[model samples]
Target chain A: ELKVEQNPLFLSMQEGKNYTIYCNYSTTSARLYWYRQDPGKSLESLFVLLSNGAVKQEGRLMASLDTKARLSTLHITAAVHDLSATYFCAVDQGRSGSRLTFGEGTQLTVNP
Target chain B: GAGVSQTPSNKVTEKGKYVELRCDPISGHTALYWYRQSLGQGPEFLIYFQGTGAADDSGLPNDRFFAVRPEGSVSTLKIQRTERGDSAVYLCASSLNAANTGELFFGEGSRLTVL
Candidate 1:
């Protein structure tokens, strides 16, 4: 079974501070995804990391993947109040049309 | 027409009742997925359909949960003998293809409350 673990289940950070959320998986996989969910809303895709050393950034959010380490990270640079939400990292277990195994999720609260 | 859509945004049912949730995937999408999200938790995979067949149903909790996509576009999830523990937000997502490179588009989800 593929297991995904995330650190800091709840985070409270002040605006303009930086933090990073870690996602570690127990099995070898080819793709990892980062998603953000606001209260009562569906998930919004943040980044799709497909290869080793792949990194993608948008605004104050950046995501990177290290396949060899079986880990992915979502880094927040200079957080803002609007960035407060729950974030999840999911792994695709290499099955054809496979379902995703998700981490418990990190709930971020950015104080202004 | 822009993204995946789910019907009956919220559903409330009594225990032991049967309920069905519907999902309409993006046009031309061949892969659909269903997941359950408990409060304060990430979405847990339930089933995956490739075309008209269920490619994987391992995440389904038990035989009481069933899903079908007969026409390969729209899908329905059926829960029999609903229990209080079954209350959660059920999410539906779809992708253009079944490859790992494809990104999933999700619907707002249907909140199921088993009272």
Candidate 2:
């Protein structure tokens, strides 16, 4: 079974600070995804890292993938209050009908 | 709908009662997925469908849980003899193709509360 693990499941950081959420998978996979979910809302796609050393950045959030190490990271360059939400990293099994195995998720609370 | 749609945004059911959840994928999407999200946890894959056929249903907890997408556009998830453990948010997602190497449009999810 493919297992995805994320660190600092609960993070409380002040606004303007920087932090990084780590995602590590147990199996070899070709794709990684980042999603953010707010209270009572569905997931919003953040990034899709398809290859080794692939990195994507949008606004204050950036994501990178390292396929060889089976790891991906979501880095927050400068935190903001609106960035408070639960972030999940999912690994695609890379099958015909792709199934995603998700990490435990990191709940970030940005204090203003 | 412009995005994936799930019906019964919130459901409260008694133990052992039968419940059904519905999902409507985005128009032209060929791949659909079902996932269960418990409190404080990430979404867990329950099943995947390619058009009218279920490509993978291995993530389903047991035989009591069943889903069907006969027409391929809409899907219904049926659960019999539900238990408290079944209380969770059921999420529906759809992708453009079978490979799922792209972004998946997700529904707001139906929160099932088995009390």
Provide the TM-score for each candidate, comma-separated: 0.97, 0.98
Compose the digit string of candidate 1's lDDT tens values, residues A11-106.
Answer: 999999999999999887668999999999999989988889999999999999999999999999999999999999999876688478889999
| Residue A70 Cα positional deviation in candidate 1, in Å, after optimal superposition | 1.5
Provide interface RMSD per model, one decimal. 1.0, 1.0
TM-score, candidate number 2 = 0.98
Docking class of 1: medium
iRMS of candidate 1, Å: 1.0
The alpha-carbon deviation from the true structure for residue A28 of candidate 2, after best TM-score superposition, in angstroms, is 1.9
lDDT of 2: 0.93
Chain B TM, per prediction: 0.98, 0.97
Mark the regions of model 1 whose C-alpha exceeds 4 Å error after superposition.
none
